[model samples]
Target: MPVIDQLRDSLGWDVVLTDDADRDARSHDTWPVATVWAKLGRHPHRPDAVVRASSVEDVVTTLRIAAQTGTPVTAWGLGSSVTGQPLPVAGGIVLDLAGLVSEPVLDEIDRTVTVAAGVRGSDLESWLGERGLTLNHSPQSLGRSTVGGWIATRATGQFSSRYGGIEDLVVGYQVVLADGTVADLGQRPRAAMGPDLKQLFLGSEGTLGVVTRVTCKVFAHPEHRVVEAFTLPDVEAGLTAMRQISQCGLRPFLVRFYDRDEAAHAVPHEEISAPVLFLGHEGLTSVATAEHAAATAIVASLGGTSMGAAPVDAWLSRRYDFSTVENLLAEPGGYAETVEVANVWSRLAPMYAELKQTLAPLATEVLGHFSHVYDQGSSLYMILLGRADDDETALARLEEIWARAMKVVVAHDGEISHHHGGGLARQPWVRESLGTGYPVLQKLKDGLDPAGLLNPGKLGFGRR
Candidate 1:
């Protein structure tokens, strides 16, 4: 019998899907390339079968069968990855983990919540809110992305400056390795017991194993929040202020710096003639107030003009809205993609300029911004908007844009991706980006997934 039939026989028809529509739906993610493919009425390597796994036992059985048959398996959540991380590139079993859920268990005393991987981020936050607690993770896809997807992609949120990224938030995980071996890693708040095993799956993109459940740190909902906006003289001034604020140990929950072009769009007021900066602090009322005031002084010292709370408030109201890109991509010949890269403080500005200059010809508009910051550096988010005569041409332009952007980023010694995992989009440059680390990744993959069946063709593994 075929692999699909075997899956159906073992897991039942309800759990194993083989129809065209089911396979196609499980095939691609929200990758811009996939979006273009959708616009052109094409599928990017549909899976042979989609297993709607409802329990850990179901996952174990599917993986065991896959291992026995030497079939590939790609784990999927809500299909929200923009880098094609969930795409079933090698057509075997697409394990739909969204159906595999357990009620969230909150330990208020420990300030931790253990949730099934399929839990949507927004839903998780809402649950926490009702109890006067919060995960404080606010990704653009919060409404759609799941906990599994966040861990798989090493996701970060807008409030990452203060709360840290998924890597920092994750306390422990339940993972199912390739050969049906189940591992429950990370039991402590901190440990020196050899290397941290959970880190292996944080950004593995389902290549190493499947992340089924996660326990993350949570905090009491902020008692107060302070928002302040500034207009910097230029990118240099804005970055300098950001670096100082970060290095001085000020933990603002939010920081957004937009380049002139992006600022024009973000602020959209005639008085705004320079780069824009927005800072937000949240926590205990007194602490939030102090941080906000300190950050304000730094901005003022850097010649930043006060823009009050109006702009920041406006942004907070619609921070999660992604319809702009959605509507653009929905057009017949439209192309929009975001390339996010990061580097140390010294190299950030130059790399940002180089990327903008290099990618200028590839797209109609290249809007840049810095949202997530650390003491050492910050993530640069570049939004490319373009149009072509037809969908085919638009797809070609999208590919070209990514190619050029990656080349520029690598040349500058910057991370090819800050939060987005190495999906099909960044697969080609993974070797160069990881340098000596790439081989180590291969070794890990070999040891954990000798058959190379888990999420093949991603993170630079099992490439033909």
Candidate 2:
């Protein structure tokens, strides 16, 4: 019997899907290229079967069956991945984690919560809101992304300047390896005995193991919240203002600066505007007020005009859905693509100028937006758009633009990726980024999964 058939017979029939339509539907992730590729009958790639696993036993059974038959296994979350990280290349079982949703257990004493992998961020946030707690990790895909998917991709949210990424929030994790062995890491608050294994799976992108559950540190809901928007004369002034705020130790929960073009595209102010900066503050009522005052003083010193609460509130309300390409493509003769890069504070200004100069000639329209703030520096998410005769031509143009921009980023000592995981598209550059450490990771993969049966052709792994 085939692997899918045997698994269906072993587990319930409802848990396994082998229908052509079903397999095709679950194959690709939310890659923007899929919007064009699907119409051309060239879907990204599809797995042999889709397995909806409900419990840890279900995962163990699926992994064991795949291991016994030497079949590849790829885990799927809510299918919100933009990097094609969940694509099943070897035609085996696509283990959907959506069925593992379970009510979270809150340990108030420890200020942490243990949640099932399939839990959606919006769902968890609402559940925690009733109990006066919050995860403080709200990525742009919060409405659709699952907890496991976020951790698997090592996602950073808008509030990362204050709460940090999923890596920082993770206290412990339950993961099932390719060999059907379960490994639990860091149940205690802190450990100093050995290397941190939990960090390994936090951003493995399903190459290492399947995360079934996660224990994450949570914070009490802030008593007060304040948002401020400022219009700056130029991008450099905005960057300088943000750097000064960080240096002064204000630590605003959210701080983002958009270039003039991006500001026009997003906010579109007629009365008074140049580049724009959005800052959010949240904490105890008194503390939040103090931070807001500090931020106001800093913006004023940098020659920025404070637009007050209305624009900031509107921007916050619609921030998550604004950048989605689907929404942009809906407009007449409109299409959009985004690329992100990270650099140290000292290099960011020059890098930004160089990136703009490099892509401006090639792209019909280009804009840069600063998001995902950190203590050290910030990330730049660049948007590009153009007119094309067809989808393929449009994608080719975008790739050319990305290539030129990446060259400038590398020259400026910046990372090629900040929040987005390196999927098949970015695999070519993985060796360049990891250098000698790349081979060490490959050896680790060989030792754990010699057959290369776990999500082949990803993160620069498997036989060429």
Candidate 3:
């Protein structure tokens, strides 16, 4: 029998979609490059067929068929990616995993929750809310993203400074390898097991395997919460205060410090011309209240000007808004993109200054914010805006902006990406970023998926 015939017989054709409409719908994700390509009457690779995976068995079946057919398989979640991670550049079968969900089981004793990877972020949060527990993993894409996508991309929540990112939340997961083998990685909270295997798949972006289920740590609802706002004279001052706060052992769940231009975008109706900072804490009443006071003192000692919680509340009320990017793309002669990079404290400031200054000429406006901080340093997110008359000019300007920014970051010894993973957007730089490690990563990829059927072309893996 033909391979296509075997697939048609193994998984009922009802679960398979090969028509033009389904292929078109599965073509692109939220990758800004997709938007540009669409406007140009072109598109990235679209899968030849889409398999609606309703269960782990379905995924296993698909992989078995892929192994025999040498068909590229790119797992699809809610498709909320901005990094073009889900683009099916391999032109084979796209496994849609958004519909496979099971009820979340809360292990109250262990303070962990086990859930199917298909669960949406908002849905999981609501289920936990009924049980008086919270995941504390609230990324801006919460409503549109899935647990598997979060784990696959190694995503970070907005309150990552305290609650931690997906990597920190994930205890273990069930992955289906390229050969249809099921691997259950990790067991105990902390294991001295040889060669921790879970970390390899955390940010693998489906290039390693398909995550079917995930078990992650959870937290009790905070008994006390406080949100405070301040304005620094400039970003340099704000950066200093943040470093101090992180180093001083004060835990602020959210530490969002935006430059002047970004502040204007954060609150359009108000006048926020200077760099702004928002600090928020939520935990035990005793711990939170005392820490809030201590944090205030520390900020005051650093000459921070208190602006009350009004600004903080305003930002909290609309933290997940993506209107800026949406509206900009909708308008003609308008272009904008956001790039995030990270480095040690010693190199962060210099890299930030270099990239910001270097891209200023090409961009009409450049805005930045430092969030998801660590004791050593922090992640810097740069949002840039530019304009050109046509798609050709616009694309050239956009590519130039990314190139200039990436060169500066690489020169400063910063990782090209912090959490978004090395998808198509960062594939070009993965080799340079990894240095000697690229060969090791390639060896790992070859050993796992020799056919190169899983998310091929991403992360500098096999070309699609």
Candidate 4:
């Protein structure tokens, strides 16, 4: 019998799936053509077998088996990723991280917590809330995406403008390597070591190892929060307002800009004559009040029209419900897709315009929104919808749209991906993004995963 067959007998039929139907279902993450029409040009590859690992031992055993058989290994989280990062191209074992749901341990004295890889963001937040603490990370996919996957992808949450991304929150990690070696990065409050090795697996996307547990910094639950919304004359005006607010040094937890179409899609036939910007502040009562005052003053100075708090509250309520994308995709003659691009403060306006102009013709409807603000600039999330004969055609159209948009971004000097890692979808642009140092990245991949057993064909380094 094959190794997988023997392993199936040892691990039980319920844990190991070899059926074609089961394999097909487990092989691919949710990469329907409608969801990627504005991002890539091809259908995602599905893995050969998906091993639903229930414990660290299972993960170690699975990796050991793959190493012995020269099979590739990829980790799967919640399948919420737009990039084909979790897709299995080499037809090997997928170490599904969903099965490892261990509860987090909060150390009130240290003001820190240890979380399992499988804990979803929203669940973790609620769990911590019961103990007078909270995980501030609130990505759009918070309800479904796992902590391990978030750290693996270096996800930026809605509050990244204030709280920072997963990279900032992560302090330590427990990882399982390709050869089944367990490595524990220090769990101390601070380390004076030569290098922070935890960062290696933080954004590794399973190329280096599997993250089983994580220790992240947490904050006390805010005593007060204020939400505000405004309308700017145009995308450029919105950008200006955002830049002014950032320069003012009042960091709002949520700062979002929706272009004309995105504003319409998000707010519906509301009489907004301009782009919409939403701001949220959270902290102690006094801090929240001060932040709100500062934010409102900046918006007023920039000719923004205040729309009260309803819109901001609505966004907060439904921030994690991306299931709507799937519903939109299921519509007849309807499709849904999103592409995110980041550029310098100066290039944001032009990049936004160029992206809209490039994708407008190909899409029946094109909407753009900006979030994940930084000191330098912000990232644009472009949502596109259209009609297509099949997933392949839709994906092809997306590839064309991204090609044009990427060209404009590169010409104007911007990074290809901000929060989203380069799965197989963005491999073509990796060289351009890395420039002269691209070879160094390949060398690192070669050194760490000599057998190329980890997430092969993704991140633009490994052999296909």
What lDDT, from 0 to 1, does candidate 1 have?
0.90
Q: Cα RMSD (Å) per model?
A: 1.1, 2.1, 1.5, 2.8
Ranking by lDDT: 1, 3, 2, 4
Tens digits of per-residue lDDT, candidate 1, 298-352, equal 9999999988899999888888888888888999999899988899999999999
Point out where model 4 deviates above 4 Å: 9-13, 34-44, 389-392
Each prediction's Cα lDDT score?
0.90, 0.81, 0.86, 0.79
lDDT of 1 at 89: 85
lDDT digits (tens) for residues 1-464 of candidate 4: 27678568657667777677656554556554424432333334656677888888888888888878788888998877777788787777777889888878988887788888887788888888888887788777777789889878888887899999888888787889888899998647667787777677766788878888888888997889898889888878889888888877888988999987888766764776578999889899999899889888888888888888998888777776766567766654446667788987988888888888888888888888888887789998888878777656665776777677778778878888888777765777888887887777777777777798998877776643
Worst 10 residues of 3 by lDDT: 1-10
Candidate 3 regions exceeding 4 Å error are none
State the TM-score for model 4.
0.93
Stretches of candidate 1 off by over 4 Å are 269-271
Q: Worst lDDT window (10 residues) for model 1? A: 264-273
Clashing pairs in 4: 37-398
lDDT of 3 by residue, 249-276 (tens): 9889989888888878765677887888
Clashing pairs in 2: none
Report the CA-based lDDT of candidate 3 relative to the real structure: 0.86
**Clashing residue pair totals per candidate (backbone < 3 A):** 0, 0, 0, 1
- The residue-level lDDT of candidate 2 at 41 comes to 60
lDDT (C-alpha) at residue 410 in model 2: 72
